[model samples]
Target chain A: AQSVTQLDSQVPVFEEAPVELRCNYSSSVSVYLFWYVQYPNQGLQLLLKYLSGSTLVKGINGFEAEFNKSQTSFHLRKPSVHISDTAEYFCAVSVLHNQGGKLIFGQGTELSVKP
Target chain B: GAGVSQSPRYKVAKRGQDVALRCDPISGHVSLFWYQQALGQGPEFLTYFQNEAQLDKSGLPSDRFFAERPEGSVSTLKIQRTQQEDSAVYLCASSLAQGRTEAFFGQGTRLTVV
Candidate 1:
């Protein structure tokens, strides 16, 4: 079985400040990792995904995450954040070759960017 | 049509009442998925369908929960004898293919069982 763990339940940062949302996963086999953002009353949107290739993945809204296999982590980072960046972020993993491609998600981290 | 869409943005059902939630995936999407999101929790997988065939339903919580995608384009999740614990946001997602593709999600239907 695969599982995701988000270290922080909530993160508060001032506008233009850098932020990092930490995520760790436990899986017996290789997996695909993803970060998703959800704004109030809206559906979740993919922020970034790490399938293959480079370990560092960049996404929309100036967000980026680095997949560290040794650490079993995929932490999302933003050099600078805006008030509009406040949303709920989720870390997810999918086992490779799984027929359904079902995603296992973490508890989620609430990112609050205040001006 | 342009994106995944779920009907009844909000639903209130009395305890013991049955409810049905609808999802319309993007046109021509080959894979559809259903998920349940509880308050302050991440969404959990409920079921998966591929072109009118239900390929996986292991995530369904109980037999009271039923889902179907008959034509593959549209799907429905039915809950029998709703309970307070059943209150949650039901989300529908679709992808162009089954594996390694990005899944697009709908706004979701908020179901409240009183």
Candidate 2:
């Protein structure tokens, strides 16, 4: 079984400030990593995913994350944030073609971009 | 539909009442998934379907929870004898294929059991 861990439960940043949300995963085999954002009362929207290729994956809303294999991490980063960026972000993992495409999600990190 | 759609955006049920939530996946989607999200927590997988066949259901918390995707397009999750613990948002997602693909999500059905 695969699992995801988000190191931070909440992240607060001022408008136009840079922010990073840490995520780590534990799995015996290869996996697919993803970042999803959820606004209040809304469903999750895919921010980005790491299937394969470049370690640095760019996502919507100027967010990006680098996949670190040795560290087992896929941390999401945004160089500059806006007040509208405030939302809950989730880090998820799916086993590589072996686990039937089910996603295991982290506890989530709530990002608050203050004005 | 252009995207996944779930019915009854919000539902309030008395304890012990049975409730059913519906999900309509995007057209031509091959894989559909169900998840449950509690307050302040990430969404947890509940079940999965490949077309009309239910292949994975290990994530369903209890026997009280049942999900089916008939005709390979629309799905329904039925909860029997709901309890306060069952209050949560139910999310449905559909993917283009069976593996390593992005899944589109629905707005979710929020269920409140009292």
Candidate 3:
């Protein structure tokens, strides 16, 4: 079983300011990490995923995340944020495919970018 | 040609009413999933389907919750005796079943139990 923890429930940032959303996870076996973003009245969109090889993963929309094995963390970061970036974000984890792997998700963080 | 699609994007059901949410996954996608998201919370896994077989349903909260993917292309989630607690966004996702592949999500059905 795998679980994800999102440290913050809400984050407020001024437009063009850098922002970071913290996520931590617990799992006994090798796992996959992901970040998804949801705008108002929309479904989740994949931001990025950490599969293997690289610890620093770049995603769409200029967002990126780093997988720190020592910390068991995958923190999402963006150097500059836009008002359009205001949305809810979730961190998810799943055990590498052995059987039918199901994704476990975090509580989600609502990002508010103000102009 | 498309992504995951869900129908009846909004549903209003009275207490004790039965409701069914539908999902049409991307063609050729072999894995489908259902999740429930309360306001301000992340999606909680409800069930998973690998083709026509329901591979896992341990996350379903109650007996009233039921899901099926008989043909493997489309799936439905049925809620019986709808309660206020069931008032939430029911999301559907699809994947290729490959290792670490991203899951595509639908707009979700907003179920409001009045």
Against the true structure, what is model 1's DockQ? 0.77
Per-residue lDDT over A4-45 for candidate 1, one digit per residue giving the tens place of the 0 to 100 score:
999999999999999999999999888999999999988999
Per-residue lDDT of candidate 2, residues B1-114 (tens digit): 599999989999999999999999999999999999998899999999999999899989999999998899999999999999999999999999966789999999999999
> What's every prediction's RMSD, in angstroms?
0.8, 0.8, 1.1
Best by DockQ: 2
Q: Candidate 2: where are CA atoms >4 Å away?
A: none
Residue A14 lDDT (model 1): 100
TM-score of 2: 0.98
Candidate 3, residues B28-78: lDDT per residue as tens digits?
999898999999888998999999999889989999999999998999999
What fraction of the reference interface contacts is present in each model, in order? 0.69, 0.71, 0.67
With candidate 1 superimposed using the best TM-score fit, by how many Å does residue A106's alpha carbon deviate from the native?
A: 0.6
- Lowest summed-lDDT stretch of 10 residues in model 1 chain A? A94-103
